[model samples]
Target: MRPLVLLDVDGVLNPIGRRPPGYRRYRCVVEGVTYVVSLDPRHGRRLLGLAEATGAELVWATTWEEHANDWIAPRIGLPSLPVVAVNADTLPVSGHGEMFKTPAVAAYAGLRPFVWFDDQVWAEDEEYLRVHQGVGDFLLVHVDPAHGLTSDHLGMAKEWLTLTGFSQGS
Candidate 1:
């Protein structure tokens, strides 16, 4: 099976503060409710291209969920892909609130090898990795707002694929 790449919309693909003035905030009406948002379009395009180049399946691991597809995907030059929506009403784990994405990602991809790109991962993520070490290939990648996806992050992803013996074309 092809490996999965769980993408976080807000901070990973879309930088928080890098877009233009008005474009910075996206307003939308979902099921009769209106909302506003902001995102970085340039980096989001790069991330989409990367997904196409790597032959990895993309799944949304974002809080925006259906809203991401309706509002964010088109802005970033990406068409709709599978999305994993978190339970919005639930309270996050006390200290590791960021790690909430982990369970959604794990459920969405099943046992497929996956690389998670998000600004939000915590000590609980490390613990999840340790506990699930024997289940399937999984890599947690932290993308910084300042640098986007750095060489180190890409290298680590490439290394994971290489170590798993997955061949790439050029």
Candidate 2:
């Protein structure tokens, strides 16, 4: 497998901040709901670099879904990427600890090694991935919604991918 880098748009890319330094704000209207987003263009380059260094394919895993491809990708200078089929508006799972999107993420990843960047990852989500029988080496990079993605998060992913032997799929 080529491995995967899963990107989340809302909290991971668009921080909780209304407007932050070094980030450009954009207005995106999808189906009549206008959303304002703060994005740093450098993040695109950094994410692409990570994927290249590790021989991974970047995929979107966000509630924004396909809209991410239209609005978020171009702003960050990233090409269109595959999106995990998960709905953020989906109701919570009966399991208290598991995230609603966890099952879809698991299904999409299958046996591939995946690095997921999201602000909502909890211990239970990590455990869910870890205990799965067929999942490959995975890294859950917890991005703070307030600050968005940082170089430190990318470093953690690189280190994990390298240590796990998933780097370059070698």
Off by over 4 Å in 2: 89-94
Error of 1 at 96 (Å): 8.0
The candidate that achieves the highest lDDT relative to the unseen native structure: 2
- Supply every candidate's count of residue pairs whose N, Cα or C atoms clash at under 3 angstroms: 1, 0
Scored by Cα lDDT, where does model 1 land?
0.66
Among these predictions, the greatest TM-score belongs to 2
What lDDT does candidate 2 reach at residue 18? Answer: 62
Model 1 worst lDDT window (10 residues)? 89-98
* Model 1 Cα lDDT, one tens digit per residue, 33-111: 8865555565456655556666677778888787777887887667887887675567344354337666566556666
